[model samples]
Target: MSVSTLVPAAWWARLGQARRRTFLGYLFLSPWLVGLLAFTLFPILAVFGLGFMEYGIFGRPTWVGLENYRDILTNDRLFLTTLGNTLYFVALSVPLSTVIGFLLAVALNTRLIGQTLFRTAFYVPSIVPQVAAVLLFVWLFHPQIGLINFALDLLGLEGPNWLGRPQWAKPAIVIMGLWGVGGGMIIYLAGLQSIPQHLYEAAEIDGATEMRRFLMITIPLMTPTLFYNLIIGIIGSFQVFVTAYVATQGGPLNSTLFYVLYLYRYGFEEFRLGYASALAWILFLLVLALTVVVFRSSSSWVYYESGGER
Candidate 1:
């Protein structure tokens, strides 16, 4: 074959291969692109647009300028309360869940009889339907005839009415929040598996006890996973609406009025789309700012297996 003929054939083959690879990549990405436009990107832009107008269901939107933002910042009393409540939930629940999940992961990571069974049991609560789980918790934490109260009574202690007091509302939510530590535990477990076994053996050979080995070797190495769970827990807790909506209805004198729950109330009940849109943007900014701070601080602590660049 002539050199020109050979070169043309090779070039055509390479071009066809490249086209096939590109087609497959787009095929895999199309669903995500569609979802972004339909569910996330479009809605977010629509909300942003809504924030600048006076939107009522029955009334045409009039350009209201920055009135919604002004009201959220300077006027709304429930806005402040719900924001405070949500912040409080994030502060308490995130740390509580992280610590609990970490401890559980460490404990279960040990080789023991029925280890798989124990892991499965711990994880089952995580997959339970939200409504069913909350209902179960309601029954379990009932002031009377509840398993919690019953157990306390058996221990010769009086369990305070968990759902009845404003002082106890946040604590109750925090406690219930710990029930799904299974998800964080699973993440930690994967991180634990990634950690080389030689690290523990080396620490032990140096006369380090189990606790010391874990603190020095495991915990430090697990910082990336720890940071991940911490951030997710904080974000999820900040948007806490389901439990408060179902359990308290933002009740006990509005002690459990979460920010997102209040956002829902404004948007759906009051038809204050413009105000809700502003609140959503405020939340997005707050989360973005906090996440930036977390990423900034991660350089001081989070240890990644990728040699810390990640």
Candidate 2:
């Protein structure tokens, strides 16, 4: 046999040894892989397949080509409205939340008395179960009887009928989103911790003002976490449903009609599975494209400690 044949055998032997050493790695990860395949990948493919059909739960799906997409694109009024509403929410909430989270992280990362407690307090809302949080916000935003209005009264400011008025309902959701930005805050906190103390010391030695230090050192180093939160927060905000559904029921004349809320209405309420599937696919495509753009742009700004000497 040629020497190449012996080389192949040697490589195969190495591969076998590696696999033997890491045998339990696959077994340990089997449950997650199975879940990804069965629940995630399978359902994604199924939804894509369904998007091209008119599917009744009990009947065979009738192939409809691009009819569902055309319907939404050409004639669906609520589709466009909900899409705009979602985009508006993302535009307003994502940046504000990201900035607020980063600022809070910067503040919380400092060495101060009861700092851990402050961090926990900020993070508390994030761990609240979704349904419970939504329901709690329902009472908190009640037009006249809510704590929000109560606080407004204390401040001599009128709290608009939050859930009652369409114009105000979306703003209410945005405010609610800010309250639960703890997830982003925690991520920023982690990123802040990862930032080398020497950078701040260097900035201090250079007589950089606090604001200048933050603008120059803190933000640049925190770009990765900021990018991560921006991407995730935007995606989550785009498909916002729980707040609209629980708080407004997509009411106040569909002012709070979110894209995912509308999708859920079609899928569950109207049983337009195919159309909902199409919406899902469209949302997936939009998020995917946006994430790609963000990642591509990140290289221009994301700092990497300049080879550990930043």
Candidate 3:
């Protein structure tokens, strides 16, 4: 049968153009689709299945049902310990970094001498390689003959062993984490610059003080940036591994045993692939839940100029 006899001429003409564009689009996207399936999606599905089995590096996978998860929930002492450590790190580091980064951004936004130089100096630490930065801090946190302790001694005070004592180990890591706040600072600076200058001028003309202008105009406008930095900081802090791994190796009575480091021990060091997969899934759920909560709460605080309370 002829094609014109089977279909309407107008519909056939439209189909030809639409089909060509669709085909071209998918053809160009084929490489990315293939890579996603091969690399990202495949591993996630494999890990999800492995979490239910008794798999390891050398042996065939044995289906054990929920045994891996049951053990992790009930019999795993290190699981709770590492979870607590990670939460503690996040609680301390996220707020400190957000506040400090915002303040630095505000200060640097002013027209001051050597302003560019100061900004560069503060940001340099964030760009330094993670391992190298941690290694540098290890020396700085030394109990004896370290620059920090030397400065404290000059002020007629004793500096506690930062990375040595259990009480101080997590705090040391928190302080180390603060060194990279410059990344957040840059984001804040951009937000600050984008705020309209006329609003500040009107407030000044209306007899508003510096503090009032800051509280009324600056803070409300900056909330979106603050919210962004807060979310990123929380997620990054939860995944803290390289610093603790290189600096303390989850030492000082396991005070620095972050969740990712614990997962790494099981997956790579001990070769308990199934157990590690379970742990990985748990971590994924924890982070996902926290992120959802933060996003839900953000509508109350985060402000957007185009659409308020977005």
**CA lDDT scores, all candidates in order:** 0.86, 0.87, 0.91
TM-score preference between candidates 2 and 3, better one: 3
- Higher-lDDT candidate of 1 and 2: 2
TM-scores of the models, in the order given: 0.90, 0.88, 0.91
Candidate 2 is scored at a TM of 0.88
For model 3, state the Cα shift of residue 61 in Å.
1.3
Give the count of colliding residue pairs in each prediction.
0, 0, 0
Best by TM-score: 3
Give the C-alpha miss distance for residue 37 in model 2, angstroms: 2.7
lDDT of 1: 0.86
Worst 10 residues of 2 by lDDT: 1-10
Can you list the residue pairs that collide in candidate 3? none
lDDT of candidate 2 at residue 37, scale 0 to 100: 100
- Our tally of clashes for model 1 stands at 0
Stretches of candidate 1 off by over 4 Å are: 1-24
